[model samples]
Target: MKTLLESMAHGCARCMYCDDSRGTDIDHFQPLKLAPLRAFTWDNHLLACSFCNSNLKRDQYPVDAAGDCLLVDPTVDDPADHLYLLLRCGEYDSYSKKGEHTIRVFGLNRPDLVRGRRDAFCLACSKPRDWHNLRQAGDAEAGRLAQALFDSPFVDVVHAMHRLDPRRAEFVVGTHTLPALEHWQSVYGG
Candidate 1:
């Protein structure tokens, strides 16, 4: 079960919530305490880091006034629809109550996570250039670099870069890196 959950996770089995640390816990998306009947349900399981599973979100589920769960379920919900990442600073801005709740419950804006995301943003910006150069030079390591880029922590940053509009992406990632990013997106379908 753990192996299956890990396989389902993104970027070397990174935590589904934080996306910065290895997923070490089988998180009950709907906590077992809150929904004991769903204890053994397959869809309830999510890969999470210790900090996110134990320290942060442990059994704490919030609901809207209408009794809808406020947390963003990564399996069923697209987080990008609710939370937007600021490419410049690695901070997340929530456009919905669910996003706001998830950010608070998961500590998405914690100092360490923010720093990690910022660093990852820089790496995501630079890796495309490196990959392009390596490919042009016919370097054997180009494939490895491409794989590493996909497997790196904070893969959300990479995907966000790809999702940026033409002018904004070019402005943020720079002209040279934008084409490479687009090439990677075309090839890798991120």
Candidate 2:
């Protein structure tokens, strides 16, 4: 637990599956009962929320027709490749079979989670949207807002908004000239 916390700077690092809640438990990706040999292995462990660990996941690890895990490892895979964020509704539109399974199994689009994500995205975007009023502010102000977005709860939701076209991301920005908007573009526009 200490190792996991230290690695993520004690911020819960968000749930590995849902990318929302603070990870609250040490979950064995491969259940100990299913893979006893790896019980003490490092790679086999990941941080998860109690809800995911005990309720949503609960020792259920699905496998493909070839017996490969359907779950995507955050350390080994790019989640965005399988899932795309819906900016307006704050839901996910899956692009793969694994993505669908991951979303269903983890309740990734649960109403509460979607609402929370929407709220976070809106709050983070407000910083850039209000940049006109911040022209006289110190250079570090914009950086601080961006940092706050990264450190705040539901960061995955906040970061996901950056994947959209700037004009489509109404909360973020529609035009240039705002330092906050520029900072967002510089960091995530690529």
Among these predictions, the greatest lDDT belongs to 1
In TM-score terms, which candidate is top? 1
Which pairs of residues clash in candidate 2, taking residues 3 or more apart in a chain or in different chains?
none
TM-score: model 1 vs. ground truth:
0.93
TM accuracy, model 2? 0.83
Evaluated at residue 65, the lDDT of candidate 2 is: 88
Q: Per-residue lDDT of 1-190 in model 1, one digit per residue for the tens?
A: 8999998776699999999999999999998888999988999999999999999999899998898899999888999999999887998989899999999999999999899989998898888889988888999898999889889998888878767876677788877788888787777774
Off by over 4 Å in 2: 9-12, 130-136, 166-183
lDDT of residue 181 for candidate 1? 84
In candidate 2, clashing pairs total: 0
How much is the lDDT of residue 24 in candidate 2? 72
